[model samples]
Target: MNTEEFNNKFDEGQSMVDDLDLSKALRSEQQLTRISIDFPV
Candidate 1:
Protein backbone atom coordinates (compact mmCIF):
# COMPACT_ATOMS: atom_id res chain seq x y z
CA MET A 1 0.00 0.00 0.00
CA ASN A 2 0.96 3.67 -0.32
CA THR A 3 2.29 5.85 2.49
CA GLU A 4 -0.92 7.85 2.67
CA GLU A 5 -3.10 4.76 3.09
CA PHE A 6 -0.82 3.34 5.75
CA ASN A 7 -0.84 6.63 7.64
CA ASN A 8 -4.61 6.84 7.56
CA LYS A 9 -5.01 3.33 8.92
CA PHE A 10 -2.42 4.01 11.58
CA ASP A 11 -4.22 7.16 12.66
CA GLU A 12 -7.52 5.35 12.89
CA GLY A 13 -6.02 2.56 14.97
CA GLN A 14 -4.33 5.10 17.22
CA SER A 15 -7.58 6.93 17.79
CA MET A 16 -9.31 3.67 18.79
CA VAL A 17 -6.57 2.90 21.27
CA ASP A 18 -6.80 6.41 22.71
CA ASP A 19 -10.54 6.06 23.12
CA LEU A 20 -10.09 2.75 24.94
CA ASP A 21 -7.56 4.33 27.27
CA LEU A 22 -9.92 7.20 28.00
CA SER A 23 -12.76 4.79 28.82
CA LYS A 24 -10.52 2.81 31.15
CA ALA A 25 -9.46 6.00 32.91
CA LEU A 26 -13.06 7.09 33.31
CA ARG A 27 -14.05 3.68 34.67
CA SER A 28 -11.29 3.83 37.27
CA GLU A 29 -12.60 7.20 38.50
CA GLN A 30 -16.00 5.85 39.55
CA GLN A 31 -16.96 4.72 43.06
CA LEU A 32 -18.28 1.23 43.88
CA THR A 33 -19.49 -0.40 47.08
CA ARG A 34 -20.31 -3.99 48.08
CA ILE A 35 -21.89 -5.49 51.18
CA SER A 36 -22.60 -9.07 52.24
CA ILE A 37 -24.60 -10.53 55.12
CA ASP A 38 -24.83 -14.10 56.33
CA PHE A 39 -27.56 -15.87 58.34
CA PRO A 40 -27.26 -19.02 60.39
CA VAL A 41 -29.75 -21.87 59.96
Candidate 2:
Protein backbone atom coordinates (compact mmCIF):
# COMPACT_ATOMS: atom_id res chain seq x y z
CA MET A 1 0.00 0.00 0.00
CA ASN A 2 1.07 3.58 -0.61
CA THR A 3 2.06 5.95 2.17
CA GLU A 4 -1.22 7.85 1.92
CA GLU A 5 -3.25 4.68 2.16
CA PHE A 6 -1.17 3.45 5.08
CA ASN A 7 -1.54 6.76 6.86
CA ASN A 8 -5.31 6.70 6.40
CA LYS A 9 -5.56 3.19 7.78
CA PHE A 10 -3.30 4.06 10.67
CA ASP A 11 -5.36 7.13 11.52
CA GLU A 12 -8.59 5.13 11.35
CA GLY A 13 -7.16 2.50 13.66
CA GLN A 14 -5.93 5.14 16.07
CA SER A 15 -9.35 6.83 16.16
CA MET A 16 -11.03 3.52 16.90
CA VAL A 17 -8.63 2.83 19.74
CA ASP A 18 -9.18 6.36 21.10
CA ASP A 19 -12.94 5.93 20.98
CA LEU A 20 -12.68 2.63 22.83
CA ASP A 21 -10.50 4.16 25.50
CA LEU A 22 -12.83 7.15 25.89
CA SER A 23 -15.86 4.94 26.35
CA LYS A 24 -14.08 2.81 28.90
CA ALA A 25 -13.00 5.93 30.78
CA LEU A 26 -16.52 7.36 30.76
CA ARG A 27 -17.98 4.08 31.99
CA SER A 28 -15.47 3.88 34.80
CA GLU A 29 -16.14 7.47 35.76
CA GLN A 30 -19.85 6.80 35.88
CA GLN A 31 -19.29 3.75 38.04
CA LEU A 32 -17.13 5.75 40.42
CA THR A 33 -19.74 8.47 40.68
CA ARG A 34 -22.42 5.93 41.45
CA ILE A 35 -20.31 4.27 44.11
CA SER A 36 -19.48 7.56 45.73
CA ILE A 37 -23.11 8.61 45.75
CA ASP A 38 -24.18 5.31 47.25
CA PHE A 39 -21.61 5.46 50.02
CA PRO A 40 -21.84 9.13 50.89
CA VAL A 41 -21.17 9.73 54.62
Candidate 1 colliding pairs, count: 0
Cα lDDT, all candidates? 0.64, 0.56
Candidate with the greatest lDDT versus the true structure: 1
Off by over 4 Å in 1: 14-41
Root-mean-square deviation of candidate 1: 7.9
TM-score of each: 0.32, 0.32
Which pairs of residues collide in candidate 2?
Answer: none
lDDT of 2 by residue, 1-41 (tens): 56786679787775445324455455344553334346658
- Please give the TM-score that candidate 1 achieves against the real structure: 0.32
Badly placed stretches (over 4 Å) of model 2 are 14-41
Worst 10 residues of 1 by lDDT: 15-24
CA shift at 37, candidate 2, in angstroms?
Answer: 60
lDDT of 2 at 25: 58
